[model samples]
Target: MMMQISIDPASNKHSLLNVMHRFIAAANNMDETIMVPSLLRDVPLEEQANNNNNNDDDDDVAETQVASNKQRDMYEHYLLLKSIKNDMEWGLLKREMSSGASFLEIAVKQEEEEQQQPSVKRDLAVEDNADLEHQFHYHLRGLFGVLSKLTLQADHLTNRYKREIGGGNFMR
Candidate 1:
């Protein structure tokens, strides 16, 4: 006897959401070595410094900064997709499918900039640590870009949802 397991192409939203939840859960359980570097993209020193300027302890700030890189790069891509899906699910960005357009253009520009990073005088002076820092910076930028977009999308969807479903009587 033979058995087959097939995923329906037209599954319902609830199942789709369940799959997303599972993905997030799996990401949460991944080891730090695998996860940390995944979340980084090159962010400017000024921005990074601003992000960490609060009174939080250095370790706390470092953990948050590093956490973004923990997921795999492919996961980062899907996470972007999921974020847009979430925006729609909750009713944020306009329901049209222009989701990846503007963002893709921006990402392409950033990738180009990443490719153009110069190896100069500092490159000669810096050691392996510099290489590591550069890697972390690139990942950090990618992470920040993804997060900022997701947040905006989520907020937009929430406002739309609230407007469409107007506030009602309490049922508690």
Candidate 2:
């Protein structure tokens, strides 16, 4: 004998919480699948190269070099995904700011930029509570899309890792 659990599809299907849980599960699966993180160290990400190639704004040699150096290997991506999952579960903690700029300075610069913008644009920023709810939903939908992509990426990485170790038959 077996017991079955019922769930309401309408309530859970497109919910932000559900999307987050999916990402967390994928991240956990990735963490378990990759036993040796160092194996991924020098492996270049295809998506990163594609993204860099798509951007046409890299006109300067220094900027191009910087962008190339900014590219992370699979190991870094694994750590990043795990870190993001941890942050999503436990909430983000503030870290020490870099020496480049202080928070107050950044805030002042933003205020100046906002002031320089047109009055009409600033007026449009003001909204009622209903608009706030709409904005929240809109951002939530975008977040869901991003998280879903990340979940798929995690699964892809796991499969890639397994293949790298000559266990190509194993996949999730």
Candidate 3:
């Protein structure tokens, strides 16, 4: 797989892998909860909290994040396996939505729950087990759109070449 090529020790993934050392070694300390793709895009719940915390009603966003037990991973993307398998973090978020919890609300509640405790360890290691923020997923959605557009462009180029240059008459 492309991931293996990029993650190989001889490969550039250690430099390129950013999130995990055995993966991307970005700055020697990438957040473990964040997906590599999400980090590459610089979208995370912590960052998003700052943007959405302008109103007094949303003030809990930042305080909650800051107050939460740091023992837990701030983001949930890297903890996901299917995302790595499919290489689609956005899909992981969508799938999380199916669990009946809105992404934003989960992000908010998680802080409230963690802050109320001192030793807040979790067991999100199960497949698709944790409730993660939506922003990470949305970032991946944007990535998916870009990838789709690129694929479309590649198809267009192939069709144009066959019809215009090769005159293959393969039109349907």
TM-score ranking of the models: 2, 1, 3
Candidate 1 wrongly placed segments (more than 4 Å):
1-130, 167-172
The predictions' CA RMSDs to the true structure, in order, are 17.3, 11.4, 22.4
In candidate 2, position 95 carries an lDDT of: 26
Count clashing residue pairs per candidate: 21, 0, 4
Model 1 C-alpha lDDT per residue in residues 56-110, reported as the tens digit of each score: 4543433344445444332343345455545645654333335655756767876
How do the residues 37-69 of candidate 3 rate in per-residue lDDT, one tens digit apiece? 332222232224433444343333323433343
* Cα-based RMSD of candidate 3: 22.4
Q: Report clash pairs, candidate 3.
A: 17-24, 18-24, 18-25, 18-26
lDDT of 2 by residue, 43-76 (tens): 7644344334533342222233323434777788
TM-scores, all models, native as reference: 0.25, 0.58, 0.22
Greater TM-score among 1 and 2 belongs to: 2
**Decoy 1 TM-score against native:** 0.25
User: Clashing residue pairs, candidate 2?
Assistant: none
